[model samples]
Target: MSAALALRQAIHDRLAADAPLAALAGAVRIHDVPPADVAFPFVILGEAVVADWSTATEGGTEQSLTLHAFSRAGGRREAFALAAAIQEALHDAPLALAGHRLANLRATTAEVRREGDGRTYHALVRFRAVTEPL
Candidate 1:
């Protein structure tokens, strides 16, 4: 499978197996990628109120989460919390990597943005995971 597809599946499987993520139900859409980054759809696994995954590099990947809710302002807290939950969910391999575990998952940035007729709290978490070469 392609790196992106593999990354997506790994994320889905990990989240599916996670108790926290299992509470929601929705297929994670592999949305956009800018240069070296892979972005997950605003809606992931279900009503998680957040989307997240890792970068599919040749060697490894990096995890990230974005929040979507009623409005960016109102969703900020939920987003931040969900992002951390995602990080915790992928804390093992092959969900993560041998040496790669979530080193950080925090909202360093946020925005109150509009989504259709409503608004939602949007936040970003910086995920850092590392693994040795196979």
Candidate 2:
């Protein structure tokens, strides 16, 4: 698998399997997009951008992985809590890439805000990943 895809898969799998995340978001509703009528607390894999980093004898890539968390709690609390767990789970945590080696992975930034609708809270967390062919 390509490094970019592998990185994303790693993040998704880590979040889906985390005990903390599961405890927070019971039933572990992580997906590409939550159903319009589905539960409030859930996570989604959002935008991603990957750049080529190829050398004469090696192939590599740099990627920006974005994830979104949504909650209906009174404030941006639940969302922020989940973001913390995600960062702890992924930042510098060794991940097995399908066909690449992760050189480094780290949390770049995370932010939470209340939507204009004023009921839903959204948290966006982004990570940077560097990988090389295995």
Q: What is the C-alpha lDDT of each candidate?
A: 0.41, 0.86
**What would you estimate as the lDDT of candidate 1?**
0.41
**Candidate 2 per-residue C-alpha lDDT over 1-134 given as tens digits, one digit per residue, 9 for 90 to 100:** 77777877888898889998888878567888778888978889888899997888878888898989888988878999988988888899899999899999999999998889989999998999889887
- Clash pairs for candidate 2: none
Against the correct fold, how does model 1 do in TM-score? 0.42
Question: TM-score of each candidate?
Answer: 0.42, 0.92
Per residue, candidate 1 scores C-alpha lDDT tens digits across 1-134 of: 43334444555666556665434323332223323432322433222122334357535434343433221335455555555556566544445423334333333333444356554444343333332233
Superposed Cα RMSD, model 2: 1.3
Best by lDDT: 2
**Clash count list over all predictions:** 15, 0
